[model samples]
Target: MSRIPTAELSRYLLAGQLTRNGCLYSQIPRIPPARQLRRPSTGQTRTLNTQSDPTTTPTTPQNAPTPAITPLRKQLKDQAKAAKASGKKKKKKNVDNQTVPGWDLTVGIEIHAQLNTARKLFSPAASSVNDKPNSHVALFDVAMPGSQPLFQPETLIPAVRAALALGCNIQPVSRFDRKHYFHWDQPSGYQITQYYHPFARDGCISLQARDGIAAEDGEGVEIGIQQVQMEQDTAKTMAQPGGVHWLDFNRVGLPLVEIITRPQIHHPATAVALVRKVQMLLRSVDACVLGMEAGGLRADINVSVRRTGAEGLGTRTEIKNLSSFKAVEDAIIAERDRQIAVLEAGGVVAGETRGWSLGSTETRRLRGKEGEVDYRYMPDPDLAPVVIGEDLVARLASSLGMLPDAEVDQLIDEYGLSAKDAISLTTIDNGSRIEYFYRVLDALEQQLGIKADIESTDDAKQRRALIAANWCLHELGKLVETAPGVETAALSGDAETLVPSAALATILAHLHSRRITTKVAKELFWRAFRREISADTVTTAIDDDGLWFKELSQDEYAALADEVVQGEEKVLGEFARFKQGKAKAYPQGKLMFLVGKMMRQGGDQRMDPAEAERVLRARIEEVHLSGLGE
Candidate 1:
């Protein structure tokens, strides 16, 4: 190769028009001030290469004419026109089948519930909430350097019980993967979750109409669970005004179970029912806290709308972080209508994530929907695959108690309680009321001086069970929940003090033996609930033959009825005047007047009004006939 002098090569490379005009070194590409070069034609634009001679101009054959070059401006306009046409075609295609008079809504949910455990899933740090901010964080929780996750075996115990309760097929071997994302709440820029292999799958919850959380019809419905996997929770991010956010690390690294459901829900009610059923199952198995209002449970609802008889599903939108059943219901309805409206307006619904406010009726877009590729899921290198043995699962299953539905059925079939009564008994406080129900039954049997078998078909025992259920649910539940002037603390304390089951059984026994009316028994119930009457007083009153309540037997009522008719001369005269006044209809008002006098004769309100009226009429007839004979 020939080498040029350093000074000459530098002068040629650094030469400019300004250098030449100023009589100094300048760039070499110099042209006249007013002259310019035209852009090369599309067909004449040559590819730069070392094999081609720069001085030669290539020519086409005479037989083939030169191709016309399109203008740059016109080409841009054509491209925009084609893009617009393509977008219009897509919009029309989406709207064509979606614009119908009636629309059907389909919904699915993904719920994340904080597992009930003492410690974090992968760290030894204690798990708690509403404590000092960032207090629960550990080295691995914040993803410090050289820190690795150590899986806690205790978490799998409750998780297995929950899976068994929900009728899930527990996997023998499950693995964790790292889902990569960038967010302020994620310290590691990735979340450890069960993606390709979850701990459990293919579970279902049976919702009964009697529970009032199922379908509108009488039959029951089952919500199918697609999968339930364990994952670490994200930190709490509180957004403030002016786009500022505060992060609380205490929530980060908490153990959670992400439950994904299949899209079988066709109505908002069904969706709410499904969530409640799952919550009940979790609570029954002591798996998750599920205090949805307190951030222990969060659900993401996927909703879509399609025209009736449509072949496939339409575009779906997800409403994230719904913490209540009302929010779940309202968000689903609002998003369904929104998609239907967009399709009916000759527009396309964008696939995106959305958020819902508690009182708002609509959903706001959070972001465009992210596909699986966007998450960049890969197996976690540091974590080992979780291996659950059959022995462990069997042990957990054996420890499980009877779930709420079975308890309800037992209350109905064995105890002879109504369906509504049985469900109410088992639904409150995770079947605490039902436990009280059994206590009341045992107490009632002991008070009545008999030991009744629950499985026996004795009418007396069935009657007693029904009576006890009514008192527990209608009277006790009402007073505990809404009774005025009742101390809340007293109601929450030991059941023996808060209207002892033994005393309540005494009141029920009086009502069952026809010694007192339901109204009188209710009065005694409140007195007992308020501690105005003790269990000793209740037993003493029974021993003294209704000293406290003044309950009248059938013979006592008959005697009182006759005495009032014969003793009240003014009342008898009033009846006689009414009978002789040529009135065709019977004087029910006068009869009630005599019955009232009989009720007030003993200065007590314990007399049965029906019995008083019946006996008083017979005595009045006997007196009138004797008067005619005289």
Candidate 2:
């Protein structure tokens, strides 16, 4: 690890770049794709993949095929079947008898989230992860023989806010301890973590049981939080299979908050939901990004199974550093079933730490799980206890803007949106998304001449808000997904980035009143979102694109309908069938496309789209009544 260059770490991490060796090095507060930049001091993780060596890797420029996916349950069943056919009767029965009924599945999780601060906990080396490995490292980070550890109070402020958000009690005085461990990444020989006394305790997360492993995003059930403590991160260790491991000390000495939950979560769905909610809430406070796969945030899960009403806990195994929420859920379910299988076959479960392989849908032993006594932890003699005064805690607490849950409630109560819609709008785990949502809503109301402070008695305001919300959630959401490079910055809460408020308001106003078709609105929106158009460009887009509300009279509609039917006889027979009472499909799908074509006939979007359609339908009925076709 020490042999690796510091520049390599900073480059790959801060740039979020794919390294030469194909390892995953992510920088916290990921910079824009347009600019070469690193975050102020954020998190980065080392995800090494030996198979990604480009030298040995075969290249297919296009059409890279994907492997077939087998369901995890199917995979497990197949494994059991294979064992049975091989005359491994004992192991076969153990695997085959792994039913989950009546067995209590208990899970507890320990999550470490990197604080979004500007400097290291003890040094000023820009705490960010850079592509340059040692670029962010201070002398103290590498254990310069004469360097001493210093405390940073700024780090504690976020720690307390994170705890407050989690409903934990903040302690006035918290002590640091030296946790002795030997890992290639820990250049100092021991990690500075909270062992005996932590900053906050007695926290709880309330949620509801989700439906299944595939649909675990819903909130459910109440889970008790044990504690959230502050700690310093160790350096990153990039390993080469059966070879030397590379170390990047840039991550060393960064502040991290470890949120530990109780073993009361017996449902896989609950565990997944809790972790996701934690990520959302923490980000709301701008505490940590949780960087899951990128290393800003990760969870260590403890899994055990016992009799439904058992008096004692079953032997448990720990899966270390399961980053993705999906991985967390799948690991717990797989491990729980495995424990059930072993216990049913009268084999004892091993108390070990395991590593999850996403490709194989299984877990393998990493080492025997370590307990508190194994570390021989002691108070750090060099550092003194961190003291938090009431004034500081109060100021920090009062400064915390609306948390995620509060925002969710506000969306539901004020806007009259359903809980499902409200959660979807806010739970995307991106702070910029929610910020943009309300900003556009406010702009829409102002464009409609409603004051920001006054609640309009007109239901029209609510209707407009719904339209804006729908557009923001659906159309804008798709834009971000499909063209994230263009739309990400604007949606990322940079007011000056692109897509000014006035243009958004104009588009939403036109859309809400059915003055323009959704297609027309989207065409103009992309211009704004990509910054190709400036403020108040919606009007120009509408005028230049020949898009305007045209209320067609019955005769005008009849003329266009006649032209369309004569030009294309495709739907004439269908229209005849509607008159013959053989079918009641008057709202023909083909007619809608024909109507759109007639409205766009002159290379212009002209018409109150809904009214034009209604008039066109009436004209068709008139043709049936006035004997024009019959």
Candidate 3:
């Protein structure tokens, strides 16, 4: 089959030889003919073939030739059939048996993100939550008749910073275009967005798979980013009883970084993971709070499942307003299943947009593909191009602080911590707590004049590192977890009265040096933190109370130890019995109960579990006891 070039097809359409009915013609008249042409020699004779000869055939005039189109018509029909067949084959291949039949699903996503800034993008309106709706709206945001659209410099910096952090390329010049759409929530019929040149483009994000642990296999898959643009949020929609809706303009004009991802994501699980990773990165840079419950961020998921070797994507339907990560995941799976079922039932899934109903956990189509409304997009003449200079980028980079990913990597490499531990520690949001924890480590090393060789640490250094890590993870983490949602700065201020870094260092140093037992160290740590006493003061108090060296009196200690030995006799007998051939039923609960009683009787002083176990084992061996009857 032969194909006509696009240029020739366009020319045919322009010349009116082809009509919308799909017809082709050799010649078309320019205008209505006024009269027929007549031969000069014969005034009333009809034009016919002339110059007939014995050996030569008569010639037909060019303009007066017969209009025989059977050959041309056959050629056109053959070409059309070939094109149609080719198209059908391509479609069939796209819908081949590679996929599970019966389902027809499509997806689209709209992300509503809270811009990382202190103020609204267009107005001097304080970007705070407590501000009144109308009060927060600047003159421009309220669409004051003569007011010009103004861009907030502060807002742009964070937006750009977030874009760069996401590995996006910042366009040198990006303009805000007006997307005209109507809603009561949108006081202005148009929204300012970068439909043409967005702030960031061609980026990627790596998402962890559903595995409980980080896979040993290199990093996770990279989801290709489509574009990240700055846009103003519409007003909050409040649904009231009786089918009425309320609009709160306070949310309007709030800067948002709308990050769109390509539909390249295949698996529903991967989609969930990608959203999580994106949320993590946004939080790491302090770009978004990512409070799914608070409506701080939302995702619009686009999903389309096609058969293997498909020439193009299947009909894509967008699931909008997936506020929670769980919802995003559930919606994708649901849509995929729905699509497969439709296909299997010999029904076509229409390309359209849908909204996820959290209550029903089903997607309802809002509009079909052809029904999509044109959001007339044009450059906003009132606003100029956003110019991003190198200085601004540098400033933003510096202000964004250390991202969590980089911090996690540092913790793993520098502290030799496990990936899980690093993720946990780096996820700590209390900035002051993080700073204080580091400060304590610094003071400990300074006071002891100990240089930690993390790579080749001897026994002493390893012990110190372990102590530091344990204290941070167990003791400090417990405190932070129990504390209310207050910044670490407040806690640090209270540190002077509570356990200061100096005091913590002193106690940890003692623990690291093995001068105090684990029980003693824990007690001292609690006391120091509770009383907010200095190390010297805590040490002196312990000494003055004879709590530090009271155990040095072997006779008294031995007596207390003997009491524990007698009390845990049953446990000791069980240990011996387990060693023998006869194995009787032993309850770990009962053993722990006896251990607790012994520790309590000794005032938790003479013998901790470790010491008690050691003593019990030795005494049990010495006695050579037989098995206790069940």
Candidate 4:
């Protein structure tokens, strides 16, 4: 056999491939080089002419048939024309009626809150956030060969409690399904989750007007809970140097309850409030560690927008792994606006998963969202169905304890607290703050000789209670968070030990009765917190410093005021010049100067500045009037 020459073989192949209309390479006329391509302007489609003709120029003839447009292209063109015409119509309507059109926003959320338990969902390994990376993994967690799942009550009980607390209808028999996905963080190719039959469903969390900025109506709004499912968590992925990633399997197989909400949230603030309420609910039951800052809780928000009266939803986007309340609101707003802008600008919004950076104003696309079919869900052959007995449910319900809402109502009705303050107290630290608040209230009541009657309309008692609440929550809470040399963790369970409730009550008692000014009370409170004074000796400390106020008779107050006025001549002259319209300084400044002198001479700045100013003003007025008459 003889091999063909390299150039002849290439020529033959090119001739066979490029020949058209049975023309040989040498006889065929070559088409002219195509013109430089021009980019189409915005909202215009660019079409390239691909027909072959040597005699014709790059531009097609005016009588040539229009290019055949596909159904998709024609649909897109029609949509663009409709968007522009509708935009013009809406603009004209707005101009005529002086009213701008509005877009209705709808938001649904999927929350993954880590279940609080001793072990992983299907393994005996411990579930912890602070454990060494990859140190807590078991054979099953890493998907080792022949390692079977072993579900325990520790995982199910907490999820059940959480679902019950949310008023969910618990299914007696819920089975596990495998959701298939390929990711570096997942050891197994599929994750075990409750899909076809979730553990709980058909619950709702009520949002009050005071709960968020969006709930303006007094009756507020109710956000429905679609379902709650049990699932296994994926491993933690940490970005390494040099564009690498490291996966820690410790988090794999950890227990999680995915709470799905209905698309009833219309505002970002309402979404935030719902998340907060969920956190409070789970933490109250001790079922989950819903700590957003600690990665224990994450939310995926689905946001969409349409014309106010449009029937169906617009194209929606999913914002994934929002770990903060602010991020939830910001991501929803950003995605909602992006979809609205796309629609108004004659473009369609694609359904995709997006991500939000810490300080970013807009969301960036991560990947196209996977549909139900993409996950390829199937029942897990290895794990058996989870069956809950009515006895177990009954026992759990009996011990359900008080939830955050109940605590909020109790605080409001019993303690005379405002709704906002009541919510704050009830939600913080899983109602631990409210317990501390009650202790402080008890101490204050005992010290002030006030009866502990819930129905009593005693204004003085309620006023004292408010005083205690303000100091404990505002002042002491700040100290607990930002005190130097004290770890925040140390202040959690033993917060009262830092400054005993007795000491706090004493400070409040003195401040309430005007025995000491607010400044002195704060100083005393801080001193007790720092252990400068013992709780048992708080009264002694105040007395020794001469900071305690003694009720003064009328004559006694006048005498003390006259002595201070006669001694502070420079301050008096300044005040007199101001009274005669000669001094440029404000009158309050001269009065404060005189009050300071009185407090200093009186041996303690703890005296009420207002009382000192009033007394000194009277004495100074008497002297000035006598001198003017002379």
TM-score of 4: 0.72
For all candidates in order, the CA lDDT equals: 0.75, 0.73, 0.64, 0.77
Over the stretch 535-596, how does candidate 2's per-residue lDDT look in tens digits?
A: 56677777886777665666676677667666555576677666777667674697788777
RMSD versus native structure for model 3:
22.5
Q: Lowest-lDDT window of 10 residues in candidate 4?
A: 91-100
lDDT of 1 by residue, 580-614 (tens): 76446677887898788887785555776776788
Error of 4 at 35 (Å): 51
How much RMSD separates candidate 1 from the native structure?
19.5
Q: Which candidate has the top score in TM-score?
A: 2
Q: How many clashing pairs does model 3 include? A: 25
So what's the TM-score on candidate 2? Answer: 0.73
Query: What TM-score, computed on C-alpha atoms, does each candidate reach?
Result: 0.71, 0.73, 0.66, 0.72
Candidate 2: regions farther than 4 A off: 1-99, 209-219, 240-242, 418-420, 427-429, 480-498, 530-532, 553-630
lDDT of 4 at 494: 47
lDDT, residue 326, model 2: 76
Off by over 4 Å in 4: 1-100, 215-219, 448-457, 478-483, 486-494, 509-517, 554-630
Candidate 4 lDDT over 1-630, as tens digits, reads 554455444333222123343445458555443323333444432222232344554555789876664576677677668878776532222113211258888899999999999999999899985776667988888666567998876799999999999989899999999999976567677899998999899999987877764733346888899999999999887763323345567888989999999998877778888998898889888887657867889999998889888899988889999999988877777787788889899998899999998756589999998888999999999988889999988999889898888878876776678887788777666567777788888887777776655444657656866787788678876777777866665436445756788788877876787878787888898898888886578788988988766655566667778886676667777767766778777577777776777777774543566677777788777865356421
Error of 3 at 353 (Å): 3.0
